[model samples]
Target: MHARTTTITADPNRIDAGIADVRDNVMPAVSGIDGYVGLSMLCDRSSGRCIVTTAWQNEQAMAATREAVLRMREHATEEFGAETPEVREWEIAAMHRLHPAGDDSCARVTWSRVDPATIDEVLDVFRTDLIPRMDEMPGFCSLSLMLDRQTGDNSLTAVYADRPSMDASRQRAMYIRDEFRRGLHMSAIDVAEFDLVLHHLRVPELV
Candidate 1:
């Protein structure tokens, strides 16, 4: 998978409108891109910083979308003003779409600092039961499960449509966690919840 991340800072006054444009206009363009697997736009309204993330089936697909992505970026800069929004990109080795939601969203950033030797049990439970159950969650439209390609630590950030939905899914997730705790596991699984803020350099639009 080819993963790309673009971080930008939006204008404080135009933050809301910019997010709208991104949702409506920019994101749709990305949705239509070649090898487009999925993407997430994470924003911080108060700080006016935005993270535009995309996942492709491969780099070739990502290459094909460059012009389209750039066009959208240019338009965003034009609409929102380029001075304040600083845009940057990063390439990820493995990308997973934890979840895809509408406008509002939430994320569960689960990371663990565990002994690599004891990972077999955690992974077994995740694959056999937890993953499937969580995938059926309401507002759980898309997901990406990434095992540290090198470290062997199970790191995942599950995405949701909104904070409320994410919050709603927790009991079920906790139930699974409790099961894991009983399966002779050691320390390592840690989860953090984040409230998604929509920000657009121009405006956040709906697709």
Candidate 2:
């Protein structure tokens, strides 16, 4: 699967309105496009940072809808009163969920860079070491790892059942993250906490 993400840092007070516009306006328009699969959103109310991601079935489908998608993105930026949004695209490397996320679910996203030659090794460690450690944490719900293999940029999101669980996992999550970084020689780019504002994505089953 392919995905496009638009990150916006906007006025904290306007986030609710922006999210409503996405749900009521942008989502319907996106759903009408050919090959459209799903849409999700993550937001940090305190910082007014939001990331909206739309998924497609293939490269061709995503490429074919670029113009329409751009318009939708522009609309979202306008609604949020945000500056030009930072846009990115990635391959959906792996996705798994122990259960569907509920309204109270929250997530932590870690962005990092690794050597392209060692991507597989990094992912192997993630699945074997990182994920298991995460699973033991209270309120763990799901995780998805996205990659831009050519650029060695990767993003991982760990979903938790509720706010307290998400908060409580911080220390151990940080330790595992450090371990992953040292083992892979990866550099951390950004890390953020967000409410799982929307979780409509239905990725194919993990192999």
Clash count, one per candidate: 22, 0
**Which candidate gets the maximum lDDT versus the true structure?**
2
The whole-model lDDT of each prediction reads 0.59, 0.88
Per-residue error for 156 in candidate 2, Å, reads 0.6
The TM-score obtained by model 2 is 0.96
| Model 1 C-alpha lDDT per residue in residues 1-207, reported as the tens digit of each score | 555656566676786676677778877777766677665666555666565666667568777776767768877755554453444232342233343455577766555544556566655665666667777888774444444333555545567888778888888877765565567354456665654554221211110
Per-residue lDDT of 189 in model 2:
99
Q: Compared with the true structure, what per-residue lDDT tens digits does model 2 show for residues 1-207?
A: 888888999899889989999999999898988889999899999999999999989888988888877777888898898999999988888777877888999999999999999988977887777777777888999888898999999999899999999999999899988988998999999999999998887776452
Q: Candidate 1: where are CA atoms >4 Å away? A: 77-104, 109-143, 146-155, 164-207
Give Cα distance to truth, residue 134, candidate 2, Å.
1.6
lDDT of 2 at 33: 88
Tell me the spans in candidate 2 whose CA falls farther than 4 Å from its real position.
none
Q: Evaluate residue 64 in candidate 1 and report its C-alpha lDDT on the 0 to 100 scale.
A: 75
List TM-scores for all candidates, in order. Answer: 0.52, 0.96
TM-score attained by model 1: 0.52
